[model samples]
Target: MKNILHVFRHDLRRATSNVMAVIVLFGLVVIPSLFTWFNVIASWNPFENTKNLTVAVANTDEGYQSDLVPIRLNVGEQVLSALRANNDLNWVITSEDEAIDGTKSGEYYAAIVLPPTFSADMMTFYSNGSEHTKIEYYTNEKKNALAPKITEQGAGEVSTSINEVFTEKLSEVALNIITSLSGYLDDADTQATLSRLQARVSGVAAQLRAASTTADMFTSLIASSRPLVDSASGLVSTSGDALQDATGALGTGKDAAQSLKDVLTSTTVALGDARSGTADSYQAVADSVDDVFSSMNAQSASSADALGAAATRVQTQIDQHQQLRDTLVNDVRPLLPESAVDSFDRAVSRIDASIARQQDLHDRLDHAATHITDTDADVQAMHAEITGLIANAKASVDDAQSAYTGSLQPKLDALAETLSVIGGDVDSIGSDLSSVAESLSGSDSLTTALEHAESLTTDISSTLTETADRFDALANALTKAMDTGDLSELTEVIGADPQALATHLAEPVSLKRVPVYSVVSFGAAMTPLYTVLALWVGALLISVSIRVDPPQGAASDLPVLTPTQTYLGRFGIFALVGFLQSSLVCLGSVLFTQVQPEHPFLLILTGWVMSLVFTLIVYTFVVTFGNAGKALAVLMLVVQISTSGGAYPLQVLPQWFQNISPFLPATHAVNAMRSAIAGIYQNDFWVSLGLLAAFALPALLLGLVLRLPLIGFNQKLLRALASTKLM
Candidate 1:
């Protein structure tokens, strides 16, 4: 210990006694500090100002003039304007050829060329759906890693902005149209239009009534002609045969009418049955969906209940832990010896903090779960209501079909029976006339009767012809008015529930976003990890040049110094230099950048501690292994770069890296710094600090204590330096 102290005092005096040596000593601290500071500063938030990197934009897009919209769509122009406004990229307006050539010549980081049909393809969104418009993003990887990456990011940003603007504008237009339509549907003009249609339908019904009246008049004429035909049969027996043939035709007509009536009745019944079945099926589906919803509700409730119970248990455990911690801290700690009290209180505090962290996580989990179940319940209730609406519609259809069948079927049956009776009367009259014609074949009034019968038949046939004409005119008029009825019903339905109709037509499904945490920006998220890596690398870089062994210019008449004295004396200087370098870098970042660490003092203190720890470990390697240690330190830097979880998460890496990460000083440094920066010192914060202390203390001890015993290994350092001639 005395020799180590002697060497330290001797070295400090040698360096300070001479003016040149003093200048060199000051240079050692200032040079590394400046090197770390300026280099880190140059790269700090490098992407923050990407305005210098040029990206050529060639927009050869034509505007699409849509008939549906008043304005022409020029998405390319909008994108170009947005690019100009945005500071993320230096967007240069140029031709395609120029853009391509510039990217090839490294004048631009990337080139984006829009096709001529960009707006035309985008306009198709209203007609069909989203159509992808290709904006050619040409990147030159040879420009360097970052430039290509940044340019691609810029291109992606432009694409997203274009999509957002187009979607927003389209939504606005559609919503405006819907709003206007809703007002128009509610206006008095809509009711007038519907009333006109209903009046037209009423006029059509009147035509049907006229057709029926004509048919009834024709039936009366048929009954009246039965007597005339009967009277003439006796006068002209052969003409009576013609009457018979007419009566048979009537029979055929009656059969056809009966068949039509039966068909109508059966069809009505079938439709009613179909409606009933559809209603039943719809009900079944609703029931099934409801059952599943109930099951989901039950499951969610069970999960929430379990989580709540678990929360209660965790709270109980926390209460118990709090009681113990409070007892140990306030009551028992004071009674314990001074040495035991500090450690006991620290242990109790760590346990209490860990418990609190666990409790917070559990409570949040339970709360989120509870909210999830509640939302699910609400969604399920909405689904049930929608199902009920569908069921009610089905029931309405069933009732309509049933009512129509009940009222119209019997009327058709009665009409068919009336036609059958008319046919029977014609047949019976023809039969009676046949008997009378044979009996009265020689009567004197035969010619007069035959003429009268012929005249009556002619008049009856004319009446039938007029009846057919009337039916034809009525059918055509009814056909025209039926269209008006359909239109009226449609208008009425839309006018009644335009809001629901519009909502359903616009978006059948919706996306609900539930945010859990505020998204942190890239700069804020990466600051802590990068600071840790930079501090460690900065320590490694400068420590290599600072020698840990006694200088050849030291007093030669003194006793030879052991390796412990050499290692300690050299480490004191390295530690001081490393501390200055790391502290300057951190302070510079804090002063210059927008780094707002939660615990500002803790950030500086942790950084300084990390510097001391890293300096000791690195100082050990340099002193014990000499130039071989420098190679090892460089190798360590490479390894730590990958395994440190500085950029990517450790779990995402290979298993070997994850297994080794917990032991690495960089890991703990980054973890502690992140907690300090984010103001979230969870259970891992103190553990990382402890690990850092554990690494630093043991390393420092081993470097000084083991340096004497490992003299053989120290001698090999000289051999490695001489034989390999390595630096």
Candidate 2:
């Protein structure tokens, strides 16, 4: 360890005396630091000046009347005033051309231009949907970035304020127009007209209700009348049946009477012959004939009387049936509609025709029986007269029979037929009544549904009327409020109302940032490269100086120590000196420039390690090859310096340079030092330290192995010098 210290002190003294080392330290340390200081100054505060912004506008608008007032508000002036009033902005108003030039020269960051017809165009757009009005913003590309952005934000705020104001004013004018129109409608005539219309609608509603009720009542009455018609038809049928039975009884009695009359006439004629001796019979025949005649006469008289009574009863029944028919035709038929009455009349007429036909048939029967009366005329003149009287009675019976059978019986039969037809008609009428009842029920249901619908409609109408009334009240209030026209109180709510001239001053624009610091400058970036190169060159020179002399006595004539002693001595001295030099430079940089050391100890250690590796490599060449090794050291330094990324980041360097960079000790040292300065070192610092150690160790071991030959050369040179001294 004492020997190592001796060698360490000796190499350090040698490095201090080397001219190349002095030059390397000055160039690498001093020059690079000055450049870094200049870089920091150039890139200063870029956003500070953006707070005081300026905008310019030009407007040549001709104002027009709005809502019967002359609109003399200059839009451009109003916009400029609003922007100027804002605390964040310092707006400078100017002509369009001048503003553009000022922005381009960076005097103003942004400028606004208001077109000449801005007011007229905006009004036209509102009234007629025109597209003539436009706002334009101009921004300088060379201005600071914050300046243009602030100007754009200010313009947007101004536009929003103007829109609120304009909309409020327009609403006021519209309300005034509505108020004037409403005043015209407040007269009495219109009110009276409306009242009359209401009354007419009410009348129509009442009439519709009455019509509905009447239709329902009519349908009910028709339904109730159907059963009565059915009952009347049943009564007519019963009457026809009774009349048919009476007529049948009367016919039976008339037939029996005719038979008895024939028998009586035959018996009387036999008695007459017996009594006139035209018979061959004795007193018994005459007496029998007399008795038979008398019995036959009595039976005939009784049969005739019975037949007359039957005929009379039949006539009475017929009279009752006729009376019922007449009553039906007169009373019930009149109550029916014309069509029903016509049907009843037709039925009655059919009955009458059938009666006339029966009467003709009865007359033919009466005529046939008249000859029997003529044959019995002269048996007893008084009896003949009686027979004549019976014949007359028979004729009367015939007449009565004819009346009953022909007229009455036929009328009854016809009435029965008519009643059957009427019953059918009644059945049809009942079906019609049923249909009418169903239709009436459906109509009732429909009316109920309609009533519900009408109630809903009335509710809807009432709601509509209420809404319209509320709307009219709202409109009146709004109209009255607008007529006041004092919108100063609304200014807080509506904000700034920009004139038509300033409408064109609202828009957004972009600005390109001009760099305050030249970050891409060549000199600022190259300082680190030169610093790394000088350090590597200085380390190589120190390594060469220590390897210049051999050991005190050795066979070889080389002027360096053995390789092992030479490498250890030089590397030890270089490590200490490099550490001192790195500490001094970093201290100077921090004190003078803004450059800070992220890891002070690591940076110092990296410098020491790099110096040791450089010293070992230089010792290996010089100890192995004597004076010729100096040229080899220079070549190695140049190669390592060129490959090291301290000059530029490794990414920007050629692919081959990056590949060989880790092999060089200077490359590792620079990377480690930069990491310490930048405060970003992690894997890079550790990896670089390991690589430098690898190079330093291997070089030191190789120097140690070649030291034997160097020591022998040193002994030989010392002995030769001794022999020269003895001679």
Candidate 3:
């Protein structure tokens, strides 16, 4: 430890005592400071001078005229007028050819040219399938790296200004139209016309009210008739059922008529036979009576007349039954299915044949009575034949009576009951239909009320049409009257402050930027990086100018120093120079330039620590490996400069650079200084300082522990370089 102190003091004295050494030491201190100060002053406020970047402007608009607007619009001229007042960039007005040539030849940073159809396109806002108004922007990107970016921002400003102007103009036109409309509304003539229109509309409304009243009456009529309609439908259905029953009854009556016809037919045939047999008997009996009673011939004549009269009565009975059957068949025939018509007709024919047979029998009986004047021989035979004939006629009459009572009479009674039911249903249906028809024809029926409502509605529609036409004519008259007055009076009537409104509409939103840990200028914000670079470069200058090892003779007066002692003693001199360099660079930043740090002491302390760490690293490498170590130090500086997040953020660097950035000493130094300059957040300043100080440990190991073992090899390397006759 004594040896280390002795060597450190001895080297310090030698470096200060000589004039050349003091001058060289002074130069070393100022060199690193100059590097940082020059850069800081150069970049103090770069964007403030961007107005000097030239951008060419060319206007080629032909202007547009609108028939409805009564004005000629030239958007290109408006843009040029706006650019003249803007100082964000240097706007040079020229022809299109000149602008393009200037931009290409690097005389201008960028060029903006309006097309010939620019104003016409702007006026096509309400037109279909229109092209957008375009301002062609051309940039000479090769002019300067940042010139294009600045000029691009200028082009964006130009676009924004154009939008504001266009919006302000549209708002003005709309406000003027609204002002005219307000004047029209205030006109007394227009108000009178509107009053008349309102009166007409009221009349239409009265008509609608009358129509609504009629509609209500119609609705009530419909509601009342619903039950009647249902009853009528039921009555019609019942009538159909009853008619069906009547048809069945007709079928029954037809069968009864058929049975009666059959009985009459059998009775007729039986009577015919009885008459033929009794005719012979009557002739013989008449002859016998004539012979036996010559003196009583008058009695025989009376009996013969009696026999003829009885035969005539039987014929009258047969004709009456035939006529009744014929009437029943004819009535039932129309009601029966078409298929039963032929059968009913045949029954009628059979009844006619039966009547004919009865008529012939009557004729035969009358002829037999008239021929009874002839004499006969047998009286007993005549009496027996007469008795047999009476018995057969009586039996035929009794059989017919039984058939009529059992089959025909009961069927006829059923048919009458069915017909009575049908008559009652038909009467009910007729009553229902009469009631419906009366309701329909009545004054307050649904159909009548609907017709009245329709009439009222048609009148209301016509009245509304006439009112609309009057309103249109009134509006046209009011427009012409208002147009005859001075248009400027409209704006006065509207009572609007156009200047205030236009200003608000043009730039409605004002941005208030609230900066966090705000930096005053570009150079001040860049102080951390430049300060860090100065510290490392200061260490490099020290390494190159001063030796890393103690002089062999000067250190001999002290006891033989161990490698650790030797390494510390030599590092003490380098560390002092690094401290001096860091102080001048950090203090000069705020003192000489415009850099104002939140914690000036912390900023200086960060620089001091970073300089020490950087010096130890370079000194260790040089001490351990001789000249090769200096080259290694230079390479390390290059890597740290690129990856240290100095000029640009570490995030913006390549992946490899970012990956190695955390391990570099400059990375932590820049971070710590930024915290101090920008106002510390959390423990960032302390943490970054701690990381930067950590580099000293590994540097101490390389110089003290590792340098001892490589001393021989390092000496050989130095000797070999010397032998090459170059360094």
Candidate 4:
């Protein structure tokens, strides 16, 4: 301990004895502090001056014509307007090509471009399903790394401003809509109009329902008529066959009459034989007539029945048409405007015409059926008359032989005339049957009318369904609105100032940040790192410029010092110099810079302790290993700068650096200073200060124990450096 004090005092006296030595010592003390002051000042408020970083803004947007609002929209222009008012960055308005070129050429930090379709694309927000608009951002990442980050922040600010603007505009539109609706609700005339509209809608709905029912009935009528139509078709076929058979029978009867006439008029035949043959021929004609009549009777009965069923079906269809026409006229027409009434009237006329045609077909079918019944009765009467004529002819056969030229010939002629008349009547009946068949076959008008009615029914049903869905949606929306509040309350809310509401809606939430241990400026927050770094550098400078070893002859009179005592003695001088350096840096930071540490005295004390520790560590390296030790100190300084977490956090460093950070003296030094500069946690300051002081122990061991073996090697290395003649 005595020898340690002796070496410390001896070095101090030698340094102050000469003016040159004192000047050198003064340089050493002030130089390291200058490094800290200048660095702190340079980075004091770097972010505050970011307004000098040039960023290009290019607007190439075409205006968009919006149907929602009367005004044309240009989102690019609005964005540019917002940016022009912003002072966060140096904004330069230019063309797209120029902005792109400037960004690529390093003339600008970044460029934001609004393309020609920017405004048009923004209008797509009102569309149903459209992609969002894009604002092209170009950045030169090769520029200063920090500058690019600041420019990116500027871009984000622009995006946020645009969002605010969009929100404000949308709020204004919504407010306007609400105000308009409120005004409408407040007006008496509007209320009346609304009531009338509701009534008209209700009426239309009812009319639709009635029309739908009528359509259903018409469709049912068509469906039910299918069987009747088939039956009518069968009747037509049967009637045609019956008519053919009657015609053939008439021709056969006519031929028999001709044969009888020829037999009666013959010269070579006997009277009795002619009479018998005439009787047989007449009987044969009667039998054929009777067969034809029976067939006609059956066919006519079936035809009449089929015609009656078809007429009944036609009547039902006509009734449905009349009901539909009534709905169109009474319920639907009054709701229609005059211009539409003509069209409605025309439609009704068409329906009436259809009904008339259907009725005509019904009447024709009825008339044909009546004619068939009358013809059937006439055929039965004719058959009875023919049977009587055959009986009289058989009884007159014997008498007819006596009066051959007189009574027999005349009677034969009369019977032949009767047969001819019956043939004509049969021909007339055949013509009536043909007419019925033609009428039944030509019933395409009825089919066409049924098809039209079915189509109309489908259209009405679809329209009714759609209307019902729309009404349901409207009811749901109104119900939800009423659930929140009544319409009167909504109107009252809308009565407030719209602009204030719009502004509130635009920015509904705000962030309130309460900083936890706030430092005033960048330089103030960074003071701990730079001040600590300067202390290390100051220790390094002392190791290089001043000698760590006491002079060999000056300490010769003292007791021979042990290596531990020598090491402690030399570190005492370094420690004094380091304390002066730390005091100067700490005072400069507190007095001259923006740094205002919470515990200013503690900051100075921490600095002093760190300086002592750092000085001892560097001094040990140099005194133990000669010039190579100085190189090792410089290398350590470099490593500490990177790993100490002074400039950045330890977590941000590489894994190896973070692992070694806790062991580094500068790391602990910076931590202790930070605790003093900001608000100290429980034992953070003491812990850091103790960790930093602990580094001095290993340094002492290297100097006291490790150097004992390297003393010869270090001496030879010094000799070799001296041999170069540079020092």
Q: Candidate 1, residues 1-727: lDDT per residue as tens digits?
A: 8876676666666667889866765665555445544554555567778998999999999878878455677878877887888888788999999999999999988999989998888779556666677778899999797788888888888887777656655555544443343244445665454345446545655665565566556556656765665566445666677677877777776766656655555555545554555455445544544554456466766654544554454455446445544544454333333334444444444555545554553455455345544676675565555455545545444444444455544555665677778777887877787787667654436545555555665565566556555444434433333434333333343344454554454454677997442223455556656666665666666565455666544445345766666677656666766677667756765675546666667777778888888777777777666666777777877888778786789889999999999878888887877776667535666777778878877776778676667768777767776887664
1-727: candidate 4 lDDT, tens digit per residue:
8888998887888889999999988998999789999998999889999999999999999978767455677778878887899999999999999999999999999999988987777667777887787889999999887888889998998888878876776677656654555346546665554455445555665666676677677777776775566577787788778778877876876776665555445421444444455455545545544554566556767655655664565565557556655655565444333444454455556556655655665565465456655655664664465456445544444343443454334555666677788778877877887787777775666666666776777777777767755544433433333344245544444446776777787798999999887888888888888887788889889988887666565646555777777778878778888999989888888888858899989998998898888888788888887877788888888898888887888788789999988878888888888888888899998999898889878987888888899878878888888999995
Candidate number of the best TM-score: 3
- Could you list the CA RMSD of all candidates, in the order they appear? 46.3, 29.4, 22.1, 30.1
Over 4 Å off in model 2, which ranges? 1-531, 541-547, 554-561, 570-576, 619-644, 647-649, 680-684, 705-727
Clashes of 3: 0
Clashing pairs in 3: none
Task: Report the C-alpha lDDT of model 3 over 336-404, residue by residue, as the tens digit.
Answer: 444445555554554455455555545645654665554553333443444454444444444444444
Write one digit per residue (lDDT tens) for candidate 2, span 1-727: 5556676665556556989966654554444334444544343233344456666655555544565443454444455556566555666767888888888888877777777776656555656557855667787756665566778876676666555444444444433433343343355653443344335544554555555555555445545554544455455555456545645644554444344334434433432332232112222222432343344344545433433343343333334334534554554443333434455455556545433433333332233223223233332342333333333433332343343334433443343344445445544654554554444444545555555555555555555555444444443433333444333432322234433212332332345888532323333234345445545565554544333452454643224454455555545655564455455544544455434456656655665565556655765666665555668878776777668876557798889988988777777677666666555534888886787678866675656775566667755765776798862
- By lDDT, the better pick of 1 and 2 is 1
* CA lDDT of every candidate: 0.64, 0.51, 0.72, 0.73
Q: How would the candidate models be sorted by TM-score, starting from the highest?
A: 3, 4, 1, 2
499: Cα error in model 1, Å? 22
Q: Which ten residues in a row have the lowest lDDT in candidate 4?
A: 477-486
Q: How do the candidates rank by lDDT, highest first?
A: 4, 3, 1, 2
Candidate 1 segments exceeding 4 Å error: 65-74, 81-84, 126-131, 168-547, 551-570, 582-594, 648-656, 697-709, 716-727
Q: Write the number of the candidate with greater lDDT, choosing between 2 and 4.
A: 4
